[model samples]
Target: MKTPKNQFWNAKYSTLVFSLAGFGFACNLAKMLLLPENTNALVFSLEALAMLFFLALLFVAINCQKQHEKWIKEGKEKSAKNIKTLMDENEDLKKRIAEYELKENEEKRFASYQEKMLRKIFSDGKSATDKEHFLHLLAESFAAGAAVLYKESEPSGQFIVEEVYALPEDFIPQPFVLGEGFHGQAAQDLSPIVVSSIDADMIPVASGLGNTSTGWLYCLPVVKEGRCVYLIEMVTFKEVEIDKMWNEISTRLVDMKIF
Candidate 1:
């Protein structure tokens, strides 16, 4: 596109060309009326000057027309380029949105699978073996490296990790108190919690003892009779959209009577 500055320059050129043409015509008319016919030299000189002025005016008009055409062509090219760029950007955004939708569908499928497994666990009279199977299924479905079940220790007023899966053979699960650690806090609040970074604030620095290799944490409370009975802990290497996923999972858990 021709910018505002270029348009202003073009207008100025047009005005100057017209003004010169008018001045040349006026001078020619005056010379024909006032100058004496006997003065041949002056008349010829004046006529030559008028001819030169007219020629210059014609040349300038042609040049200005060419410049205007060039600017118009450039403006069209720029508009085409801008349209192509916007179309490319729109396509890229559509592709990204499709990929995200596919990922979201996969997550929902995983959540559904977890719900089925939990239903089976609870349907089997809440057996110890069933709970173990449920924990294992959750670990696999959520792609977590480890999953643990924790129960509150009333005597010590702490929450103890009762069952853990995919843990190192020698690693021991520790006890933590309410508001003391991430897991405990989740259990205390009866709300799901996610820690994206271990080094971040609000997460206990010393709480990640055995799982130093993992960077993210997910904690969910297993509520029973409107109270937190157990806590599900998951450790992952990458962060998950915990709030969004948990909201969906919580709804499924309630529907499946696992909450």
Candidate 2:
């Protein structure tokens, strides 16, 4: 259970001590051989035995040092693996939390939008067929820079702009058949359409100061009695999650139909 650092120091200390002891024994044996008068048979035999003992101790210390080094290597590799595993788990947890928070925020936005629409439709007793009022309200609720509501002509089967909110005075609405363009496609399919990366000249909002270009355009269809009667187009500088609220609005509008 020794730490790598402690094991390293212990191995080094043992090697040093055993090496010094072995070297000292060898020196003594050499000295005894030089002084032949003092080198008796019995004394030489004892000195040789002592030298062998030190050599054995040195060998054991060297082997123990190698074992300690192996243990340290294994410990470092295991520690590194554990650290990597923890880091991967932490990254995964962060991703999950971010996804959950994004979903929660979208739900909150949808709830607030629905609540405001309900108040305008029922609490204020505003007629659902009032295209101008609803167009402005929808644009304000979704924070759009500009909005336009298109109504389908009953006889001609073409969609034409009926109401506009925050558009330039010089701006004109283009009329199109059900399958002609993005606005028409949403009405034809009875579904929402999203257009992105629009240029500044495409949908421009004029103010007293200047004109600002919108980047995103959303086309939402209004269904009544199994048919699309209106297509609302709104533009904003940035994208918003307005698509999810379509289902709720469609349901309420269908329920409140005059036919």
Candidate 3:
């Protein structure tokens, strides 16, 4: 766990030790040279001992230098690995942040689209056909293929289709009474329902009229003055949480004076 800086310092210490040992050996040889001819056998023995000691010190110093070099190389390797790990982590963080930002932008754009649709629907003197166009635009924005607007007829007590868009040209609008079908139940309760599987509780209707009934369906009630004034139906190939999206749409509708 020693850092590169510490390794450098250690290497310097080893070099210093080696250099000092060599200097001491040179000083000892100079002292031996300054001795007179009368220097005794003991002096010669002492000289030999000094030479042996210097050699031993030199060996130790060389070993220390090699060990220091090894440690320095290992430190460099570890430092490189640490730097690489940090770089990789930083890149991953950047990618995740970018993804989150993109998702946030998409949500904002979808909200703006919903607001525009609501404004078009509730504009003064807007016709049923105009509202149908707005609904279709809304569905298209959400990537849905078909959309329908249904309202309850008070005289007949039946849910009559008020506007339909993205349907086949030959398809005809149909009516259903409360408690009779899924759409009727959704309207009567003023609640939203999402059907992931069509075979669960749905009654099969005519299919050749561009009503595939092969994918997910969403029914959302549009309540006005404590009564359901309209029902929004959407069909899609993938399961979608239309209720959650509807909550955001409703908030935008209120803000835009569409409800």
How far does residue 233 in candidate 1 sit from its true spot (Å)? 4.3
Extract clashing residue pairs from model 3: none
lDDT of 3 by residue, 4-35 (tens): 57667776887797788779888988888888
Residue 74 shift from truth in candidate 1, angstroms: 3.1
Q: Is candidate 2 or 3 superior in lDDT?
A: 2
| TM-score between candidate 3 and the true structure | 0.51
lDDT of every model, 2 decimals: 0.71, 0.73, 0.70
Error of 2 at 180 (Å): 1.9
Candidate RMSDs in order: 8.4, 5.9, 7.9
Q: Which TM-score value belongs to model 1?
A: 0.52
lDDT tens digits by residue: candidate 1, 108-224: 886876566546544554443466776776677557888788876786446777778898888787877777677777777778888777653453544533444347778887665
Clashes of each: 0, 0, 0
Tell me each candidate's TM-score.
0.52, 0.64, 0.51
- The best-first sequence of candidates by lDDT reads 2, 1, 3
